[model samples]
Structure formats: C-alpha cells, structure tokens
Target chain A: MTRCRFWRLDRHPEGNTDFARFLSLQEEDCAPLADGEVRIATEWLSMDAGTRMWMSPRTDGYQPPLPLGSKMVGLVLGRVIESADAGYPVGALVRGFGQWADVATVVPALTGLEVVDETVADPRQHFGALGMNAWTAYVGVKEVASVKPGEWLVVSAAAGATGSLACQVGRNLGAKVVGIAGGADKCRYLTEEVGVDMAIDYRNEDVDARLAEVPGGVNAFFDNVGGPILDAVLGNMAHYGRVAVCGMVAGYDTDAPMPGPAKFDQVLMRRLRIEGFFIPDFLHRGAEFMPQLREWLDAGKLAVRFDETAGLENVLTAYERMLTGKNIGKVVVKL
Target chain B: MTRCRFWRLDRHPEGNTDFARFLSLQEEDCAPLADGEVRIATEWLSMDAGTRMWMSPRTDGYQPPLPLGSKMVGLVLGRVIESADAGYPVGALVRGFGQWADVATVVPALTGLEVVDETVADPRQHFGALGMNAWTAYVGVKEVASVKPGEWLVVSAAAGATGSLACQVGRNLGAKVVGIAGGADKCRYLTEEVGVDMAIDYRNEDVDARLAEVPGGVNAFFDNVGGPILDAVLGNMAHYGRVAVCGMVAGYDTDAPMPGPAKFDQVLMRRLRIEGFFIPDFLHRGAEFMPQLREWLDAGKLAVRFDETAGLENVLTAYERMLTGKNIGKVVVKL
Candidate 1:
C-alpha cells in the first residue's frame, strides 16, 4: 500500500480566510481502487474559488456543501498510476475533480476523469490554457455574452485564471477589452502581458466612474466577482447588454449570501440579459469548444500566468491567495 | 376650436399614491392638426404602471423622465377626428400614445398611430385582448420565458392586467400555471377567473413556502412586481429557469430604485436566465402577434375584466387604484 498525505475538511469554514482552522493535513494508507475507479498519483492541484463554496455550509450553491471529515475536493491534474476503469487506463495523464491527496482515488464517471493529451508542450496547460478555466472563458465570452467585433467587453477579476483567458478570448474575437483588477501589478499585467485595451485598478480607481467613461457603455461583461464590482458594471451597461455570471467569489467564503447589486434595476432599465453559467454544465461541449481554444493557445493569443506554490502542505496558503485576490493569475499547488 | 381637458404634470410624484398633488386637470382649445399629425377624440385612456415610472423624477428608467408641466401621455383608443397624414383618415378608429385628454393630438409616426379593425364585437377588446398588455403578455410568456408544455409557470401580480393575460397565455400554451397576487380576492380571481392551477396570496401566505410545493420547481416566471415576490420566485426556480421581467412596479412608484432581489445569487446557482423587455420595442411585430391573440379572443380563451372608472376628471383616482393594486384586471378611464 502506498502511503498518502491528504487534507481532510475538519469543519465547515466561516469565510475564505479561516481554512486552516477547519482543515488538517493527515497521512494514510491508500485503499485498493474500487471497480470503475481510477487512482491518480497527484502531481499538481488547481486552487479554485468554487471549492471554497463547497467548503461552506451554504445549501444554496450549485453543488451541495462538502461533508465534514472528508478529503478536501478540488481539481486535480496528474497521471493515473492504478485503474479499475477501462476508459481511464494506466499511465494516462488525467484531470478532474479529485481529493487533495498525494494519491487521489476516484470513480471515473463520477469525477469526470478523462485522459488529457500528452502532446502539449506544458502538462500544466491542462490546468491552464486547455483546462476547465479556458472552457469557461470560451463559453462565457463567445456563446453566453455573444460578443461581436468592435463591441466593448469588460472583464472583472481580470487577473485571475478564467478572466485572463476571457480577456484574450474577447480580444481574439475582435472585442475591445477593459480588464478590472485589484492592484497596479495585475492591472499592468492585463494591459501589457494580456494585451487588454485598458486596465482599471479597482482597489485604487473608482470602478463606476471609469466604466462610465466607456464609449457606448460596456456591451458585454464577463464577471467573476459579484458584489460592488457587479453594481458598478451594471450601472454602466449599454442598452441591451449581456452579463455572463461566471463566479461570485465575493460571496464564496461565507455562509451568508452577499447582498444583491444595488444597481440591479439597471437590468430592467437598460433591457439587459443576465445569465449564470458554469464550466461543468457545458462539459459535453468541450470537444466543440476545444478546436478554437487550442488554435488560439497555439497562435499565442491565449495565455495563462501561473502563480505556483510547491508542496501540498501550502495548499491553504495558495487557496487563500486566489480567493483574496492576492495572486495575479491562476493559483496552483505542486504536490 | 374643440375644447380639450387634459392632465398636466405639475411636479414629479414621490410615490404611486401621491398623483393628486402633482397633476392638475386643465382645459385648452385644440389647435389645427400639423403636417403628418392626427387628432383623436379620446374615448378611453389605458392606465398603466409604466406611466407611473415616468411620473417619478428618476432618470434611470428606460425612457427619460417626463418633463414637468408637459401633458401626461398615455395610450388612447378613439376615432381620428382630424388628420394631416394620409395613412390615418378622418373617422378611422385608432390607438396610439397620446395625451390624457378628451381630444388627443398626435404625430402618426411618433405615437405609433395605426387604424384598427372596426369589425370586432367590442372596441374595448382593442384595449383588452388586442392591446399592448396582451402583446406584452404574449411575448413575455412564449418568447422570453420559453415555458414548455407541462412545465410550472409562476406569474407575479397575477390579478393585474398583464399578469392575468400572462397566466392565460401560459395555460393556452399547455403549461401548469401558478399565479401570485396580494389579497385573497385577487388570489380567488386568479384561480377561478384567470384559471390558474394554483394561486398564492402573497399578502396572506408565505410565497416561498407555497412555491416550494411545486412538483418540479417553477420552470418559468413572468414577473410584474419585483421586490420580495421576485426573491421568492428566484428561490424556487428550477435549473435553467427563465425570468421575463415585464415590470418592476414595486420600484416604479419611488424615485429611489428598489434593491435587487435578495436571492439574486440564485441566477448563478440554478443557471437561470433573467431578461427585461417592454412593449414599445416590440411594436413593429404587433401585426405578427394579432392573429393568434384574435383567435384566442374569438374562441373565448382570452378575456379581460375591466375595472372601469368614469370621467377623465377622475383619471388620477383610477390611475392610483391601478398603481396601488386596488383594482383588478384592466383599469381604464372613460372620456
């Protein structure tokens, strides 16, 4: 039996910052893989805001609250070392929802475990450019927001994984992009490295005032944070604007829901459309979305900056960074 | 010269109830029709919640605030007594946006003036089954909400003009309809007269608790009132549900915007779609909508209860009644 170390959720978290108090790192012997299950030798784990909601006791999330005393669940990218499933064979690179452990044992069908291409220059791209975040950015910006050429597209949490890719996706689709981020560094990265038309430092700048200056108002919004920033964007939306609600990281940490945006009346006032979508709901359409995502990635139009942290012991640190907007891009922990 | 009695805006009202303090009944001699203008001897004036929004000094509504001291504008159903436009000849019955006056002067193109079919059994049917409210109900139910057969549909303010029509439209399309309104009488009117499968008295019962009893959750929502009622409906919406925001009458009364529904997060949690639309944008498709509405009316499937109030001098009393939900169904003033 292989010895494995995993973070167990000891209690439901109150907010994003208190994860250490609710979770504990423990070592255990790996149990034999059940039939139709695959065991992955975890090499890296993607820290996402969604997992933070599952960690709370909130009953209103897309997925039910994670039961206490269970292994913390998150996106895992690694190789399948042992398998009882025919589809996920041994020696295959895989990515899906798996435990935060050195060896993650998961039911292939239940975990959405599937083999990933090994031909990509960087295996980490599985969690970056060609991953769930990219799929979300692609679907949200292209299909949901219905962005057209020369239209103004605004992205919130623009320095993060999905938002960064969404910015590039909007740009590649010929939309003029305005990225909203927390600090000068992320703002600079958005305008310089990410090639956005403009970057608003939300922490220092008045988001509402800046967005008000947008010519013809913002026609499309790809939103991750759904609190004050959402209100600011809603107030500045053009007539018949579309808002693709990708995430509400602002309310993920707490059990209580964040209050609805103050300017939500703008939805009716401007005759707008607001739609909420997640990547998992569109999993079946990954094949349809992949060709375009890959082409942009290969042509250097789509890029993701990795805010990497080493060791599973520091997963909490990396997660807090992502949740609190401390990191500039995708936050990942190397096992 | 013909004498004209019209309501003029003296000041913006603070709430739906205070119209008496802001508007005054005044008389003036009607001027000769200008080029492309048509004059209508107003027979009936449609009382609408939309005009209530225009009465506030709020600048955030779809249309600009109605300028103080201008004639109060409303829908007029009458005969064209004078015309400079060839399209609308004298003696033709017409309906369009015109002044709340005995003799309404209008530019045919600007006010959406169009001659009506005179053969219908009741001219009031033009303000009932074939009116703007019916068109709004049809578009909101069939196109915006996208209610499928056998699905549960919830309509707020179900005793109001548009809401009642929406409930019938949903039923006509084979959807299971649930109507929500404020009083027991309104609830009775919904279930008995409107033929809704279920009726919840929002003032007497817990809307959220009652909606929770829906077998498969509410699949579509035609919301006229947007406050706690909206929040209740949001909490009970099925996965991928659609909300057609026809009006936000709860906020229409005040200059300050109503806060968004407390369960706004449900949009993301349930993967819902919320869209806002008004009748004016769809005026061009009135011809396309008329045949089906006429069929329903002719077949006895469509009906509107007129809460008739006599005299243009009492227009405020009638308008206030409609705005405050004191009257059921279509409220109109006889000139």
Candidate 2:
C-alpha cells in the first residue's frame, strides 16, 4: 500500500489569512480504487480564488460547501498512476478536480478528468493558456461580454490567471484591452509582459479617473474581483455595455454576503447587460475551445506567467498568495 | 394665438409627494410650429414612472436631464391640430413624446410622432393595449427576458401599466406567471383580472418565503420596481434565469441613486443574466410590434384597466397616485 499526504478541511475559513488553522495536513494509506475511479500521482496543483467559496459554509455559493473532514479538492495536473476506468489509461497525462495529495484519487466523470495533449512543450501550459482559466477568458470575452473588434474591453484582476487570459483574448479579437490590477508591479507585468493596451494600478491610481479617459466608455468588462471595483466599472460603461461577471474574489474571504456594487442601478441608467458565469458549469465544452487555445499557444499569441511554489507543504502559502493578490499570474504548487 | 395649459418644471422635485412645489400648471400662448414641428390637441397624457427621472437633475440617467422650466414631457394621445410635417396631417389621431398639456407641441421626428389607428373602438387603447407600455411589455418579456412556454415568469409592479402588460404578455406566451405588487387589492387584481398564476403582495407578505415555494425557482423576471423587491427575486431565480430591468420606480421617487440588490452575487451562483432596456430606445420598432398587439387587443386577450383622472388641474393628484402606488392599473390624465 502507498502512503499519501493530503490536506483536510477541519473548519470553514474566517478570512484570507490563517488558512492552515482550519486545514490540517495528514498522511494515510491510499485506499483501493473504487469502480470507475482513477488515481493520479499529483505533479502540480492550481491555486484558484473560486475554491475559497467551497471552504465556506455559505449555501448560496456556486456549489454546496465541502463537508468538514474531507480531503481538500482542487484542479490537479499529473500522469494517471492507476485506473479503474478504461478511458484513463495508466501513464496518460491528465487534469481534473482531484485531491491536494501526492496520490490523488478521483471519479473520472465527476472530477472532469481528461487526458491532455502531450505534444505541447511545457505541460504546465495545460494549467495555463490551455487550462480552464483560458476557457473562462475565451467564453467571457468572446461569447458572454460579446467584445466586438475595435471595442474597448476592460478586465479587472488582470494580473491573475483568468483576467490575463481575458485581456489576451480581447486583444486577439481586435479589442483595445485595459487591465486593472492591484499593485504597481502587477500593472507593470500586465503592460510590459502581457502586452495589454493599458494597465491601471488600482491600489496606487484613481481607477475611476483612469477609466474615464477611455473614449466612448468601456464596451465590455470582464470582472474577476467584484465589490468597489465593480462599482467603478459600472459607472464608466458605455450605453449597451456588457459585463461578464467571472469571479468575485473580493467577497470569497468571508462568510458574510458581499455587498453588491453600489452603482448597480447604472444597469438601467446605461442600458447595460450584466451576466454572471462560472467555468465549472462550462467544463463539458472544453473540446470545443481547446483547438483555438492550442493554436494561440503554438503561435505565441497566448501565454501565462507561472508563480510556482515548490512542495505540497507550501500549498496554503500559494493559496494565500493568490487570494491576497500577491501573485502576478497563475499560482500553482509543484509537488 | 391659441392658448395652452402646460405643466412646467419650475424646479427639480425633491420627493414624490411634493411635486406641486416644483411643478406648476401654467397657461401659455401657443408658439408657431418650426419647419419640421407638429402640434397636437392633447386629449390624454400617459403617466409613466420613467418620466420621473427626467424631472431629476441626475445627468447619469438614460437621457440628459430635462432643463428646469421646460414643459414636463410625457406620452401624449390626441389629434394633430397642425403640422409642418406631412406624416402628421391635421385631424390625424397620433401619439408621441410631447408635453403634459392640453395643446402639446413637438418636433415630429424627435418625439417619435406617429399617426395612430383611429378605427379602434376605444381610442385610449393607443395608450393602453396598443401603446408604448404594451410595446415595452412585448419586447421586455419576449426579447430581453426571453420568457418561454412552460417557464415561470415573474413581474414586479404587477398592477401598474408596464407590469400588468408584462404579466399578460408572459401569460400569452404560455408561461406560468407570478405577479409581485404592493397591496392586497393589487394582488387580488393580478390574480383575478390579470389572471396570473401567483400574486405576491410585497408590502405585507414575506416575499422571499413565498418565492421559495416556486418550483424550480423563477425562470424570468420583468422588474419595474427595483430595491428590496429585486433582491428577493434575485435570491430565488433558477439557474440561467434572465431579468429584464424595465424600471426602478423605487429609486425614481427620490433623487438619490438606489442601493443595489443585496443578493446580486446570486447572478454568479445561478448563472443569471440581468439586462436593462428603455422603451424609448425600442420606439422605432413599434410598427414591427403593433400588429400583434392590435390583434391581441381586438381578440380581447389583452386588456388594460384604466385608472382615469379627470382634468389637467388634477394631473399632480394623478401623478402622485401613480407614483405612490395608489392606482390599480394604467394611470392616465384625461385632458
């Protein structure tokens, strides 16, 4: 029997910091695979802000809260070590919602487990440009927000995984992209590295004043951090603007409900369309999006800067980094 | 020179109750029509809540603020007394955005002036089943909200003009209709006269609790009153539901911007769409919508219960009654 290390949720989180107090790392003998289950030797773990809501006890989240004492679940990338499912052959490169363990087990269908293309140079791109984050960006910018060529597309949390990809997606589609990030460093990365048209350092600059300079107002907004940032964008949108609510990272830290954008009435005032979307709900359409993403990757039109943390022991650190807006790009734990 | 009795906006109104303090009923000598202008012998005025925003100094509204001292603008139904434009000939029954006056002058093209069908037994139907309100309900329920057959549709301000028409439109589309109103009498009217499947009296009843009883949650919402009522519906919407934001009467009474719905985060949780639409924006499509509305009216399938107020002097009383939710249906001032 193989020994596996995993994090277990002991209690709901209170704040962004001190996540370890509620989760404990434990070692146990790996259980025999049940029918239709596959085991992965976890090589990498993607740290996502949306998972914070799963740790919360709030029933109003996208999905039900993870019960206490359960192994912490997340998107994992690795080779399939063992399989009870014929589709997931052993040694196949796979990615899905699996445990934060060295040996992660998952129900093939439930965890959205799929074998990824191995031809790509860096397999980590499966969790980057070719990942769910990229899919979210593609769907939000192109389909939901309906960004037209030559339109002004504004992205909140633009230094993060999804927003960065959203900016690129908007640019590829011929939209003028404006990115809003928390720090000067992140803003610099967005403008210099990601090559966005404009980057607003939200923490250091007047976001409202900066956005006001965009002629004809923002045509589409891909919002990852909702709260006051959402309010700022709402007030600056053009008539008939579309807002794609991708994630509300601003409210994920607490159990208390997030106060909505104060300027929400602007929806009517400006004839705006605000639509909220969660990526997991759209997972089945991955095959439909991958070819274009794979092309973007091959052409160097799409790229992601990885903020990698070594070892499973630092999973909480990476999570906190992503949650606290300290990471400039996709934060992931390498086991 | 012909004389006219018009309501002038002396000052921006501070509240819904004291309209008399800001607006005065004044007598004016009718000015000569400009080259493209048309004048109407105003017979009746449509008291729409959306007009309240024009009386406010808020520059951020759908249109620029109406200048103080301007004649209060509203939908006028009457015969064209004179016209420099060929489309609106003398003695032609018409409806357009004109003044709240006995003799309303308008620039034909700007006000969306159209010669109405005078053959209908009740000419008031131009301000009723065949009116802009009907067009609003048709477009909002069918196009914006996209209420489908067998889906559950909820309409707020169910006893008012657009709301009542929305309820009927939803019903006509084979939807299970739910109406939310302020009073028991209105609730009764919604269920009995409008024939809605469910009626929620928001003023006295537990709205959230009642909505929880809806099987599979509300699929579409036509919100005329936005405030706490919007929050209640947002919390109870089904996954992938649509909300057509038609009006914000709750905020229209005051100059202050309305606080957003507290449960707006539910938009993400449920993957919902909230879109705002102004009726005037869709005015050009009236000809495309009128045939179906006229058919519905002639078939007796669509009817508007009129809350008629007599005389121009009682316009303030009628306006206050409609604004305060004292009227059961379409409130019109018979000039």
Candidate 3:
C-alpha cells in the first residue's frame, strides 16, 4: 500500500492551530475509480481564506460540509502518473482540484485540470502570479469595477498574491493605486516594489481618514480583507464608486460574528456599486489575461514575488502561516 | 402678502408622525422677473420621502439644510404669469422645482421646469406616472438592474408609485414580477391591478420560504423598503442576482441600528451585484428609455396607478402617509 499524508477537517478547528491537524491517506486501499478517472501526485498547494468557510458549518447550507474523514479540498499542481481518461496523459504536469494528499484520483467533471507548458520560466508561476489569483484580480478590477485611468484604486491585503497583482494591474491601467497591508514591511514592498502610489498599514493608521489623502476619494476598491476595513472604506468612497468584493481574509478566523453592520447605507446614499466575483466566474477570459500579462511581464512592467516553501511536508504549516499574513506575495510550495 | 402654508421638520422626525408644524412663505409683493428669472403662481405640489434625509444633515453633503422660516423644497406645477427670461414665456404652464407654497419666483438653473401640454390625460400623470418616481423606477429596473425577459424580478413597496411602474416595466420586459408589500390590500392591488406574477404581504407571510414558489429564485430585486424584508429576500436570491438600491422607506424613521448584518459572505459566494442609483445617474439614458417607455405606454403594455390628493394644504399629510405606506401607486397632489 502506498502511504500519503492528507489534511482533513479535525471534526472542529479550535483556533488557528487546528489548521495543523490533517489525516493520512492509504491511497492504494481506497475505492477504485470508475472508467474516466486519473491519478495525480500533488506537488504544490494554494491556501486561501475561502477554504476555511467551506470547512465551517455556518455557511447557510450553500457549501457542502467537509466530511469528517475525507481529504480537504484544494487546488494543486500535480503530475498524472496514471489515467483511465484519454484526454489527460501520464507524465503531464496539470493543475486542478485535488486532495491535500500527495496522490489522488479525480473524475472528468473535475477537469479545470489543464496541462502546464514546460517552456515557461517557472512552472509554479502558472499557479501563482499568472494563475488563478492574478487572473481573478485582473478580471475583477478591469471588468466588474470598470476602473478608468486617473481613478484611485484601493486594495486591502495589498501585499498578498491577488492583492499585489490587483495593485499592479490598476497601475498598468493608469489608475492611482493605494494598497492596504498589515505591517510596515508589506506596505513598503507594495508601494516600492509593486509600484503602488500609496500604502496603508491598516494595523496602524485609520483607513477612512487616510483616504482623504486621495483627494477625490477612491473610485474602485479591490477588497481582499473584509470587516471593519470594508466598513471604513465604504464610508470614504467617492460617489458612484465601484467595490470589487474579492475575499474576506479578515473575517475568517474570528470567534466574533462577522465584523460588520457594514455601512451598506453608504452604498445607496453615495450611489455606489459593490459586486462580488469568484475567479472561476471569469475563467472563459483566461486566455485573454495570459497574453496581456505576458506582455506586461516581458516589458518588465509586471513584477512577481513568491514566498517559496520547499517540500510538501511543510504544506499545512505554510497554509497556516499564509492565513496569518506571514507571506509577502504568492504563497507557493515547491517540490 | 398672501400666506402660503408648508410643513417644517421642526424636529427631525423620530418616528412616523402626522408631521405637525407650521411653515409659511409670504407672497412677493413686487414680482417682475429680473433679467433671467420667472415669476410663477404654484398650482400643484409634491411631497416625497426624499425630503426626509435632507432634513438632518446632507448625507452626501450635496444638498443644504432647509433653513428655518423658509419654504420647503419640492416639485410643483405652476403658470409663469411673468417672465423676464427670453427662454421662459409668460402663461407657460411649467413643471419644476418649487416650494410647498402656493407661489414663488425661481431661476432657470434651479428649474427643470418644462412647458406642459394640457391635452394629455391627467397632467398630473406627467408628474406621477411619467415623472421622477416613475422615471426613476423605469431607469433603475431597465438600466441598473438590467432585468431581462423571463428573469424573476421582485420589488418592495409594490403598490407605491415607483413600485407599480416597476412591475409594469418588468412585465413589459417579459419578466416574471413579484412584489412585497405591507398589507393584503396593497398585495391585492399589486396582483390584480399592477399585474405582478406574485405578491407577498411581508406582514402576514413567511417571505423567505414563500419565495421558493418563484422556482428559479429572484434574479433582480428592486428595494424601496430597506429593513428585514430585504434580509429575507436576500436568502432566496440566485447566483449573479442584481439588487437595485432605490430607497430606504422601511428605515426612514430608524434612529438606532437594526438587526441585519452586512451580507458580504453571501454576496461574495453567490457572485451577486448590488448597486445604488439616483435617477440622474442615467439621465443620459433617457434618450433610450423614454422612446421605449412611450412605445409601451402607447401599446397599452404599461399601466399606472395614481393616488391623487387635492390642495397644497394636504401636501404634508400626504408626504407623511407615504412614509407609512398609506397611499397606493404614485402619491401626488393635484392642483
């Protein structure tokens, strides 16, 4: 029997550390797959706040619960060693929904799993800067927010994978970008490295008052952190502002009820637009983003930062660390 | 000097009241229009809930306080018996911003004052069904919400002027329209008269559970009343649903906080779009809406309900009654 480690919901996550406990899977002993199935060896894993809500029972019956003993759900970069499906071949490096384990089998319906090109400078970039995180940031800022040149684009969790990419995308579109991060170091990296016009360490200064510095106030806000920050930003937004609700990183771990009676009152009185978007919602536009992002990268207008963790053994720890805002950019686990 | 009576917010309305307070404006003794002004005798007056928010401090700081001992701000129909402006002719029956008073002098800039064609059915219909309330309802549902054919559209304050017009507009667009109202009488009018697909008396029925009857779930929700009912309707929304934030009649008198939390979690997960709009935001789109609405009106596909009150003396009472959902359809005071 082949032994593989897996992360499962620990019946209950007591606190931050509960992100630590995951079960081991004996893959060779599990039930056999039906006709169209493929087995993979997971190389890299992506961690996000959305995964936490999926594990929780409080999701209003919208999300299915993570079965007590089943492997946790996540996106991963892996190689297909075996296949019952003709489309995906052995030795292909593909990315898709996979168990947190090193090896897993998936059906054809779970096929967002696409083979990666070996010619790229770094294969991991396909799962990070040029991947789902960056693509989501790009589409939401450009399409949903409809941000125009010279407008102020404010983003929270601004040094993280999606947030940093969003700030860069905003700048490339000629918008004045303001980033909100947790500490001084992250804020510096966002403004100096990512080329954001301004940076706010939300842990220190007041977000709403500092927004007055933008003069005309924010035109579009790409939010990765939601809670008091969302409430504060909504109050200072300009009339007819657009807010792209991207992630709720701030509210995930709190024992307290979600920190909002979010001032949606401002939403009406100011005639603002707040839209929520998931990356997969715009997957059809994936090809469109690739060429444009490639152009920016080729011109050195795009800069990517990776918080690289070596080996799959530290994957769970890296995920926990990512959630606590320890990583500066894309959190990537290297094989 | 002729005495003109009006209602003052003597105090910010703590709760819905009869709105008892004396406000008077004296008739001008010398009223030849000075260069670019017009002197007019006011005939009809309109009192709306929009005046409520402007009472405290301007929420957007765009409008100023209605000064003590001054006339209340509203729209009125009047005859320009005297005109100093070359553009505005004498004896012109114009509709524009005026006081709750019987007469006033106004400049061209403060006036959208249009010359009325008296041959039309119910000149007040121009101010009611075809006026700001109806126009707002039209633009919000058509432009902002973008209600398409066969989509489920639900509206709050379903028997009010805007609500009634929105139901017709939704129907004209081939949408299945649902309305939520306070009483059975309003619900009956919404279905039997305004011709909605379904009507929910929020006071009597379980709003969330009954919405399951709509099958596909509401695709668009035109919210006039902002309170618990909005919270209830939110649960029954489909993915990618649109919410047009028009008014907050339910919380017009609310001084303290209500129980509804910010629904960002559901919003993000469902990929919903929530937008607040002022009618003027789409003034540029009137060239698009007017011809189509006129076509619908001429084809008899659209209908309107008007609650016409007579005399300026009843304006304050009518306005207060509107806040409490007392009137059905467009609440207007005819000359």
Candidate 4:
C-alpha cells in the first residue's frame, strides 16, 4: 500500500469559496495496482475557473456539480511509478482528470489518460498553451466565430489562459485583435507580448467608449469574462457579428444571481451570433489543432506565461487568486 | 398631378410612440411617372414591429434610424395604376418598401418591387404567410436554429405573425412545439389553431414553471418577444440548445434602458447558441423558401390570421396595438 494525500469536497460552496470549510485534506492508503492499472505520483495540478463551477450548487451547467464527500475533481500531470499496464510503462509521464492528490491509481479502461513526451515540449506547456487552452481558442476562433482577415476581433480577459491564446490565434488568423484586461500590466502584456493590436485596461478605461472608437466596429467578440464587460462589448459589436462564449469567470464566484447583459438587445439589433462551447466536445479535432499550435510555438508566434504556485498546500491561495483575477496567465499548482 | 396622402416621421419618439406628435399626415402631389417608372395605388399596408425600431434614436441597429421628415418606411401591397415600364403593366399588384401613402411610384431598377400574382394566392396572404412573416420564420427556424424532429422548441409571442408561422413550421419539422403568448385566447389559438403541443399563457401562468414540466427540456427557442420571458426560457433550455433572436417587441416601445435576461449565464453553462438574424440577409434564398411556403399554404398545412384595421388614417392605432401586443397574428392596415 502507498500513502496518498488528496483534497475532498466537504460541502458545496456559497459565494466565494471558503476552501477550509468546503474542502478537507485527507491521507489514505492506495491499494496495489491491479493488472492494466498504473499508479502515478501527481506532479502538477491545473487549477482553472471551471473547477470553481463544479463546487457550485447549480446542477444545470455542462458538467455536473461535484458530489459531496468525494475527491475534489481536477486535471493533473503525473509520472507513472508503478504500472501493471504495459501501455503505461514505468517512468512515463501522463495527463488526465485525476483528483487533486499527491498520487493516484489510473485504470486505462475506466479513465482517459494520455502519455506525454517531455522531449517534444515541456509537460506544463501541454497543460496550458499546447493543450486545452489552445484547443479552445482554436475551435472557438476558427470553427465557431469563423474570424476573417482584417476583421476586428475583441477578446475579454485577454491575460487569462484561454483569452491569451485566443488573442494570439486571432492575430495569426489575420484579425485585428483588441484585448480587454483588468490592470495596466496585463493590458501591456496583451499589446506588447501577446501581440494584440490594442488593449483596454478595463479597470481604468471605459470599455464601451474605447470600443466605440474602433474604426469599423468589432466584428467578433471572444468573451471570457462575462457581466458588465460582456454587455458593453455587445453594444459595440458591428452588424452580423459573432460572439464565442468561452468562460464567465467574473460570475463564477458570485452567490447572488448574476445579471445578464443589459445590452442584449444588441444581439437582436446587430444580428450577432453567440455560441457557448465546451472544449471536450471538439477533442476529436485535436489533430487539426495540435499541429498548428506546435508550429506557432516553434515559430515564436505564440508564447505562454504561467502564474505557478509551488506545493499542493498553497492550492487554495492560488485558486482564490485566480478567481479574484490576481494571476496574470494560466494558474497552476505544483504538487 | 394626383393628390396622395402619406405619413412622415415628424421626430424621433421618446417612449411609447405619440402618433400625432412624432408622425404627420401630409397631402402631397404625386409626380407624373417617368419612362421606366410605374405608379401604384396602395391597398394593404404591413404594419410590423420592425417599423417602430426605425423610429428610435439608436443609430447602431441593423437598419438605420429613419431620417426626420421622411416618409414612414413600411411594406405595402398596391395595384399599378399608371405604367411606362413594360414589366409593371397597369392593374398588376406589387409589393415593396414604399411610403405609408395611398400612391407610390416604383422604379424597378432602383427599388425592389415584386409583382404579386393574385390568381396563385391572395395578395394579402403574400404579405402574411407567403410574404415577409413566413420568410422570417422559415429562415430563423430552418436555416438559423436548424430545429430537428422530436426536439422541444419554445417560441415566444406565438400569436404574432412570425411566431405563429414559426410554431407551425416547427411542427412541420417534427418538433414538439411549445408556445408562449399573452391571454388565454392566443394560448388556445397556439395549441389548437397553430398545432403547437402546448401553450403557456404568460399573462396567467409562470413560463419557467411550465417549461420545467417539459420532459426532455427545450431544444430550441425562437425568440420574437424579448424581456423577462426570454430570461425565463433561458433557464429552462436543454443542453446545446439554439436560440434564434428575431425581434424584441417588448423593448420596441421603451425609451428607457431595458434589462436583459437575468439567467443569461445559462448561455455559457448549457453550451447554448443564440443567433440573431435579419430576414433580408436570407432573402436571396427565396427560391428555397417560397416554393415550400406556397405548398404549405396550398395544402392547408399553414394558415394566416390577420388582425387588420380599415383605412390608412387608423394606421396609428393598429401600429400602437401591434407594438403593445394587443393584436393576434399579423397586424396590417387595409388602405
């Protein structure tokens, strides 16, 4: 038996997560791996805004709410130390949806696990730029929004994981990208580093006024932060614009009912197309995504920055920071 | 010179349109027809909710706000009285965006004028079931929403022109249709006359509670009336649902800022797609729309109910009633 430490959901959260009250850290013994099973030592845990949604009492979301008294759900990068499964050889790195734990036993048939090649690219890149974030931005900009060259595309939360990638991808697709971020630093990162044509410091500047100054108006909006910003963007959208509804991190922490876009009339008046998507639905098109993303990464056309915290003990702080928009890029915790 | 009576935009309205203040009845001398022009005597004028949007001060809508002192723009069915053009012979019926006037001179090259064949279908039917209303519903449901058989489709304002047609069309596509309308009469009309599976009297019953009673949930939403009802429907939508935003008659009369759906977060959580569409953008597909609509009309699979008032002088009352949801089916003025 191997000793394992993991976080368990003690209760559903209200408003902002009270991590200590809703989650419990427990140490347990893992049974020896059966045939076709591998025991992995968790190395890094990816904390995303989506994780917060699972803790909410709302059951109508795409993914079901987390069950009370179960291991808190998350995606993790791990190394296979003990493997009875020939497919997952010992010393190989793997990635999958495993609980936030120091170690986990993965059954090949029962769960989805992908072997990672560290030599090709860093494993962390796979978790951020080269993985879910890139795939989401790719499918959203190329497939859903169908962004065209010279078209003005606006992206909210431009400094966040998916938004950052979407900004770069929109530029690669020949779109004139306008980014919206909270602070001066994130806004600067968006324009100077991420290569967006312009960045609005939403905390300082008026989003609607700034957007209205754009010459031809916003042809597409890639929304990550929903709320007043989303409403403001809706008001500035050009005729027949498209909106790719990615994430609403702004509303994830609120216990009170979040209000819809007040300017939703723009959706009707401008003939906008707003589509909400889940990345898992487009994983089948990974062949179409990974290659282009890899090429861009190699060409230096794309770059990823991580706001990483060391140790699983600090996961709560990292998560709280992410929910409060304190992190600049992808928020991750090393176990 | 022929004396012609027309309605002109006197000024932009503040709230519920003051017909006498914002609009003026003017007696004008009709100019003689040119070599390629035809003069038509207006018979039936289509008074739609879209006409009210043109009177608002908002300049960023799909159609521009009506310029002050111009004729109130509307679709009209008329008979050609004088013709210098061979294509538009005398006594032929025509339909186009002409003034709210008794007579209009149409130049075939400059303006779109469709010559209606009364023998094939009544000219008034051309304005209702076989005209813009049917086309709007067809494009929104078939092309935009892409509703499938057995899918539960909820249509707002099911007693209105486009909504009524959308209900019938959803049934034709094998969908279980639920309609939201005001008053018990309109609700009864939706279920019995329009062949909807269920009808929710929004005036009497709670839309969200009734929609929750639906077994499979709402697969698609054909939204014509946007307001609290639209927000309620958002909460009841099924996963991967589609919403076709056709109109917002509820907000058409308001000068005050309108609040959007309070439950719009459902748009992201449920992976829903909301598309706003204009009928004119799909007008090129008339070859695809007209034949099918004509067939439905011929087979009695579709029927049109017109809330018509006599005389152009009463156009103001009819327009007000249409905007306020006082009329059932298509509201028109028989000039």
- Candidate that scores best on lDDT: 2
Candidate 4, what DockQ?
0.73
lDDT of 4: 0.84
Candidate 1 chain A: minimum summed lDDT over ten consecutive residues — where? Answer: A279-288
> Residue-wise lDDT of candidate 3 within A62-86, one digit each (tens)?
3566777677777788888888888
Q: Native contacts recovered, in order, as a fraction for each? A: 0.72, 0.79, 0.48, 0.86
**Of the pair 2 and 3, which is ahead by lDDT?**
2
Instruction: Return the TM-score for each candidate structure.
Output: 0.98, 0.99, 0.93, 0.94
* lDDT, candidate 1, A105-166, per-residue tens: 99977777778888999888888888899999999999999999999999999999999999
- List, residue by residue over B130-181, the lDDT tens digit for candidate 4: 8888999988888788899999999999999889999999988899999999
- In model 3, the clashing pairs are B161-B329
- B143: Cα error in model 2, Å: 1.3
Q: What is the TM-score of chain B alone in each candidate?
A: 0.98, 0.99, 0.89, 0.94
Residue by residue across B139-159, what tens digits does model 1's lDDT show?
Answer: 999999998899999999899
DockQ of each candidate, alpha-carbon based: 0.81, 0.86, 0.51, 0.73
* Candidates in descending TM-score order: 2, 1, 4, 3
Q: Model 1 chain B, poorest ten-residue lDDT window? A: B51-60
Candidate 4 lDDT tens digits, A268-331: 8888899998766665556567778888988988788899999877778888877778888888
Q: Show model 2 residue runs off by greater than 4 Å.
A: none
- What is the alpha-carbon lDDT of model 3 when measured against the actual structure? 0.75
Relative to the unseen true structure, what is the C-alpha lDDT of residue B66 in candidate 3, on a scale of 0 to 100?
61
Poorly placed runs, candidate 1 (over 4 Å): none
Model 3 interface CAPRI class: medium
Q: Model 2: DockQ against the native?
A: 0.86
